[model samples]
Target: MAELSDGVAIRTITFSLLSSPGLFFTFLTIHYIYRSYLFPYLQPSMSPAHIGVAIFALSFQITNGIAIGGWLGSYGPTTSSNWAKHDLSVYLGTAIWALGLGLNVWHDDILRSIRRRRGVVEKGSGEKVYEIPTGGLFEYVFFPHYFTEWVEWAGWWIVGGVACPPARIFLVNEIATMLPRALQGKRWYVSRFGEKKCEGKKAVVPGLI
Candidate 1:
């Protein structure tokens, strides 16, 4: 077996590499909750359902984490033939995800600017109107976060040279869980912003979905 200069076994290296996405996603879920939900709650008023959604998101994240761990643990490492020689696709996909994440930040900043300009006045529902987000990704897609997430993990699989079976399993699980949530969120957006705002925007994927 090929050995590292430090005498680390190739199996150890491969296993660790395969497990990286699981750990990364775990960290992301933690940070996402704190930043997205906890920070919003620090204000005087926030809807109970918003908190509930946060909890639900965390719960799903936990399930996914466990699934990833089990998958990686079972597979341990990917052999060469297990995945196609498409390493370039892995890098390209990762860059796409990074761009999506950057756009997410940009979208948030724009919302913050709008909120600041509009001032923080309480709405009739006792919640601040248009405080979170409802344009760009929010308007165009219900779960851009999840979209980016799937893209990110797709990159992880590519980079690790993981095969299609595990990737398809994850995809199926995401569609089962997230698709309904996306549809619900789309309905909420339409109710709030009107059908005009959501025009030409698909629920999850763009066209061809």
Candidate 2:
């Protein structure tokens, strides 16, 4: 029910737009546009469960976005200079977001290139298969993308501050979903290639989990 002053609201929105989550969301929109529409990559035919999960994921992001905006709008400006007010946390979040996005894109490129080299193609069933990625973060984590995503959200939470309820909600939801998926990916890899091949790799986090 608390509302920021008009001037404070304008400054907050401006800062938020220039921050990590905003930049990442912009990049993600473009990335998906290219991946889903412009690229000639074979699309996976989604199962019903997959569709449901995708919907839920999209919905969650939208809800989190709204919540974050509302939370920011309720907070007053901390300093006269807008940049100085959010400098540290915003910059930290941006760095983490950039790293995560880079790693995710790099990993995907590796997977796609490997599939191409192996002559893997989509079947009539609309399923494409890829070999296990072995370099970079993949060398340590079974699902490096997932791990990076968590790191990105951690940065977002840091910028949003612990006092923001919506920020906490986003962090918790992300971990709950991504952790399970990372574990599932690990299991799949183990089942396909045997435990010997995946012996040293952790599920999502390195060495800790």
Candidate 3:
């Protein structure tokens, strides 16, 4: 009886940890879909190649969902042990992700309202969209969404615990690949909006990098 109870408890805990990362990433995956596929498809200067790259990057994280889910199922212990220790890092990390996501939601709503007021609908498709901005966070940073996204994965890494190679790989790829794009994006915005207006905004990190 004792062994059986322990086994069930362990299984439950492992399952929880394994599932938690997937859930966090899911929110992000959905967020990207809403923006890339559903929202516009209508950027004035956006090219087919740019759209393709965007889709590739957005889909990359979602693809990890399968690997993560599989890891939890395979190596996950089926018996309760001393491994069920609570880490405050996980909670704090999750909170940061939630906060970033919340900011994005609010920002989108504000931009959407502004577009409605401006009477700017899609060119021929009739879908509604907010135009690219020169104000708010956009006034300072070109890729706030990318910034929050980086933070979100960092949070996932924290909550998902150490030695999670899959999470580390995801973070590494994002940093290596996206960081350059972010810098380019910053330059793009500056060219469009002027550099003087973008004071005090770092490229990726707040004050550094």
Enumerate clash totals for all models, in the order shown.
0, 0, 0
Tens digits of per-residue lDDT for model 1 on 60-105?
6677667655554444333333323554555664565466556545
| RMSD, candidate 1, Å | 6.5
Alpha-carbon runs more than 4 Å astray in model 1:
1-86, 108-119, 123-139, 162-168
| Residue 60 accuracy (lDDT) in model 2 | 77
Q: What are the clashing pairs of model 1?
A: none
**Candidate 2: clashing residue pairs, number:** 0
Query: What local lDDT score does residue 59 receive in model 3, on the 0 to 100 scale?
Result: 86
Error of 3 at 81 (Å): 4.4
Of the candidates shown, which would achieve the greatest TM-score relative to the real structure? 2
- Candidates in order, TM-scores: namely 0.55, 0.70, 0.62
Residue 171 of model 2 has an lDDT of 68
Native-referenced Cα lDDT, model 3: 0.59
Candidate 3 has what TM-score? 0.62
Candidate 1 vs candidate 3: the TM-score winner is 3
- Maximum-lDDT candidate: 2
Q: Candidate 3, residue 53: CA error in Å?
A: 3.5
Model 3 / residue 149 / CA error / Å: 1.5
lDDT of 3 at 202: 60
